[model samples]
Target: MSLEIRIAAPEDAFAACTVLRRSITECCVADHKDDPAILGAWLGNKTPQTVASWFESPTNYSLVALKDGAVIGVSLLTGAGKLALCYLLPEARGLGAGKAMLAKVEETACNWGVKAVQLHSTATGEEFFASQGYVRSGHVRSPYGVDTIFFWKQLDRGAAPDTSQRKRFCNCNSA
Candidate 1:
C-alpha cells in the first residue's frame, strides 16, 4: 500500500496516540513483558493531550503516515536533535512508511542545524536502527528499568540509505 507522510496537526493527536498505544501494547511485549505496571509507567505520558501539545509545537517536527487517509505511523524529531517518537501500527510495518518518515525527520533535523540525532530505542528497535546506519552510543536505564540502547547517527550526504524499505519485523516493532 502507498503511504503519504505529512506534518502532524493538533487534531491528529488522538490518531497518533492510538497508533502509539496499539503498537506498543500489542507488539512490544518483549520490552514490556505485558506487565501492567511497566506498561502503565511507559505509556504514562502518551496521552492525546501530550501528543497534541507536541503536534502544536512549531519547534517539534512531528509527522504521521497515512494510508487511505488513516494514520498508521507517527514520528517526532525535536529541535534538540532527539527522535522523541516513531511508531507504526502492525499492519503498516512492511510498507515504506517507516523509512520515509525517518528520512523526513533526518532531513528536518539537518535543516534545523542539528549535526547528529540521538534516540533511545527498545530491544525491538535496536536492529532496525542499526540497519538504518545508527550506531549504539551506549546504554541507558529505561524508566521501567530496562537497559535501552542509545543510538546516534551523524547527518551527512551519505548517512542512511534511502533504500526501498525492507519488510522485517524484529524485536523493535517501532522506535
Candidate 2:
C-alpha cells in the first residue's frame, strides 16, 4: 500500500511517542536496556508529556506517515535545520518513506534559509543518512553509552529557483 504523509496534529502526540520509544528500544539503544536508568536517560526520559511538548514547539516540525488510520513513520526537524527524530514502524521499514521525509526536511530547511542540516544518527540509520548525502562529522555518545554518528549536509542554496518554485517543491505532496 502507498503511504500518506502529513503534518502531525496535537492528538497524534501519544502515537508519536510510541514510535520513538520503539525505535530507541529496537534500533538505537537496544543493548543499553540492561541499565534501566541509563536507558531512560538515553532516550531523554521521554513520556507522552515530553513528546507532546516537542510537538507544541514552534521551532520543530513533524512529518508523519499513516497507513490506513495508524501512524507508521515520522521525522522531526528543528528550525535550526537539525534533524531531531526519525522513526518508522518495523513493518514500515525498507520503503521509500524515509527518503521522502528526508527530502521534505531538506526542502523545509532550504525555505528557512538554512545553510546546512545536521543530525545525530543511530547505527542502523547511519547508512541511510549517508545515502541521502549527509557526511559524517563526528561521533556522539548517548547517555546510555550508545554511540551515535553525527552527520551534516550543506544546502544547495542556488538550487531553489525562487519563491514560486520553492513553494511548489516544498509542497510536492500537496500537488
Candidate 3:
C-alpha cells in the first residue's frame, strides 16, 4: 500500500501521539526498563495536551505518514534542529516510511537553516539511523529514566564550504 506524507496539523497531534507512544513502548523495550511504573511515567502516560503543545510550538515541526487514512508513523523536530523524535507502527516498519519521514524532517530543517539534527536513539534505531548517515555522539541516560545512544547528522547544505578550507583557515599561520 502507498503512503501519503504531510506536515502534521494541530488536530492531528492526538493521533500522532498515539502512534509515537505505541511505537516507543513496543520498540523501545530494549532501551528502557520493562517495569510498569517507569514505562507508565515515561511513554504510556503521554496525553493529548502534551502533544498539542508540541504542535503549537513555533520552533517544533511534525510530519506524519498516512496509509489508508490512518497515521502510521510520525517524526517531530524541535529546538530548531537540536532534537528529533521518530516512531513507526510495527505494521509500517521496513517500508521506507522511516526514511521518507527523515528525509522530510531534514528538508524542513534545511528550509529553516538548521545546521544539524540530533536524536536519542534506541539500540535498534541506532543502527537504522547510522544507515541513514547519522553518527553516534554518545550514550546518555534518558531524562525519562533509561539509557540510550545519541546520534546526530550535519545536514548537507549542497553549497557549503569544504572542510579542507575550514581546516586550513583554522591554522592561523597558514596565511
Candidate 4:
C-alpha cells in the first residue's frame, strides 16, 4: 500500500474527522471499553467543523496520512509542545503510518524550536509511543473517565527538562 503524509488542509477536515472518530471508536476499544457514555463524551467534539478549526489554528499543526489517496490517520501538535492527537483507523495499524506521522510531528517540533513533546496516550497507544522512544512520565484519570498514560520525549539533549506543572491536553478532549 502506498502511504503519504502531509500537512492537513481545510478541505481535508471531514476525512480527517472520520479517521479520528473511527480510530477512537474502533481502535481505542481498550480505553473506552465499548461504553456508549465514554464514547459519546470522547467523540463529542470530533466533528468536521472542529477538525477544520484545528487545521486553521495558527498555533496548531495538523497532519493527515493517506493510504492510496484516502485519509487513514490524523495527528495534531500544539505550539506548546503537546502532541494532542495521533490516531489511525483500525485497518491502518501496523502499516508504519503512525510512526511516519510521529516522525514528521517530531521534525515539525524541532523546526519550531520545541525541545520536548508530550502526550497522553490511550491504553491501546501506549505501546506504540513507547516503541517510538517516548518515556512514561505519569498516569492520570482523564476527563472522560479513562486512565491514561502521559508520555514525553526530549528532542534536545542539551535542553533542561520541563518541570513546571501544566494542565494536560488529553487526546480525547483536545480543542
Top candidate, metric lDDT: 4
Off by over 4 Å in 3: 157-175
Q: After superposition, how far is residue 55 of candidate 1 from its true place, in Å?
A: 0.6
Q: What TM-score goes with each of the models?
A: 0.87, 0.82, 0.85, 0.89
lDDT of 3 at 77: 93
RMSD list, candidates in order: 11.4, 10.3, 3.4, 8.3
Off by over 4 Å in 1: 157-175
lDDT of 1 at 104: 96
- lDDT comparison, 1 vs 2, better candidate: 1
Which of candidates 1 and 3 is the stronger one according to TM-score? 1
Q: Per-residue lDDT of 1-175 in model 2, one digit per residue for the tens?
A: 7678888777888887787778767765544655777667766755778777787888998888787778877888999889988888777788787888888888898889888899988788989999999999899996567678999998974675446645444655884
Worst-scoring 10-residue span by lDDT in model 2: 160-169
Error of 2 at 152 (Å): 0.5
How many pairs of residues collide in each model?
A: 3, 0, 0, 0
**Residue 158 local lDDT, model 1:** 62
Q: Which regions of candidate 4 are displaced past 4 Å?
A: 158-175
Q: Ranking under TM-score, best-scoring first?
A: 4, 1, 3, 2
Instruction: Judge candidate 4 against the unseen true structure and give its global Cα lDDT, from 0 to 1.
Output: 0.94
**Could you give candidate 4's per-residue lDDT for residues 35-151 as a string of tens digits?**
999999999999999999999999999999999999999999999999999999999999999999999999999999999999999999999999999999899888987899999
- True lDDT of residue 174, candidate 1: 70
lDDT, each prediction: 0.90, 0.80, 0.81, 0.94
lDDT score of model 1? Answer: 0.90
Residue clash pairs of candidate 4: none
